[model samples]
Target: MDHLYAMSLDLNALLRDWPFEPGMLKVRKVTGVDGREKLQMRIDLGVLQMELTGRPDGMRPHGCESLLSYHQNRAALAKAAGNEYELSAEECSELQQEGIQYYHRYVSLFQLNDYAGVIRDTQRNLDLFSFVDEHSQREEFVWNFQQFRPYVLMMNTRAKASLLLNDGKFAEAMREIESGRDAIVEFFQKSNFPELVSKSSEIAFLDEWLEEVSEKRPRSKLEIMQREMESAIAKELYERAAELRDAIKMLKASK
Candidate 1:
């Protein structure tokens, strides 16, 4: 906890000042397996520009960091309460000092056989951290976040389409969906967790629920309508999943 207060006070100052280029630019790089060329990107941020002129590979621990960073203030809390390691019933106050606080707190929790406490602490900071902390939350977020760190990378046009659909920009969204199939699929394959190719239960329960969408749908027209809805949702999913497949191909080819 030494200089804990000073650490927060100097985060920005500690953050090295890096330069950026106009418009969307790239500033992250990775060397080829043979070590000849490097992979890169070009994108705009909320407020910042970057160019990957000649970058070096730095180990990015996005897998572990995202979860830890989300509940980081917890570490600061334990610190402020004084280094009390006695494992009686007590709530750790989340204070803020360094990002490392999150790392230490969880590390200790794991060592101290605090399974329930670990899950509780993680759930408590679910939304605040990033993912919802549900099943596969770590797998889902780790892969997603790792795919686009240092440079906030985006490898597929379907990602663009997802944004468009989200923003009510149907035309653009559909456009990418239609044309970017290969790119999307390729992106998925390159991802750390490729099985996300089939996204898990978000709103897909209709397929399962409909096996018996209530015994009430015994009528002719109701059954037909339910069947059609199932077909349409499935079609939409097929198209989306196909895009990821192509993205995977492209990524592997690039490698």
Candidate 2:
């Protein structure tokens, strides 16, 4: 197996060329064995597969829960042993690096319209930040994690809002946006970093989204009927689906 692996590397080098572009990025949705939809990005080198939730590769670290879960479990064990929850800089760094990988996957998931996946990954990172802040007690480490909390909250809020909007819950989505902005502001203000809060691009984004939602025209009857038709079909309510389909056509024709 070792010899075969070495030969494969040689073959890869032999086939390699200059001006490589990593080919084109081709994306597709796939359903995993667990019956969840996922996304795969294909390139010349290889294909990258990601889950819609939990870890990007769908692998459980430590053969159980995530790093966040592992830390929490250990913290409990430490308490039982009458020891304090302690983590080195290296452990924190490792967890942070793991988070970066999930961040990449979540970005791709967002682009693929997988808002739930984005929410899952963002929440995981947020949990990590909370865990470090509570346990580490290192001022520098806490400060560094603090810098990312607002951004994580913003991303989580965006994902939640997007999901809500997809379900035609516009009011709830708008509220989520507003609340997210307020949360960021509050976090910074509490930390005595009001300047950082003011400079956040996410605050501007939330404001713009708020304005857009508030000022946007109401959905046309035809549009609403069409969405209802889709919802009925998804629910397998054929009779209701037919009614909504006809209603959509009637509304469209009247327009």
Please count the clashing residue pairs in each candidate, in the order shown. 21, 0
Strongest candidate by lDDT: 2
Q: Which stretches of candidate 2 lie over 4 Å from their true place?
A: 1-38, 41-48, 57-59, 217-255
Tens digits of per-residue lDDT for model 2, 119-221: 8888888888888888886878777776888878888898999898888788888999999999989988888677887688888888888889865636767
Give me the overall lDDT of model 1. Answer: 0.37
Worst-scoring 10-residue span by lDDT in model 2: 11-20
Q: What local distance difference test score does each model get? A: 0.37, 0.78
Q: Over the full model, what C-alpha lDDT does candidate 2 score relative to the true structure?
A: 0.78
For each candidate, give its TM-score against the true structure: 0.18, 0.69
For candidate 1, the per-residue lDDT at 58 reads 23
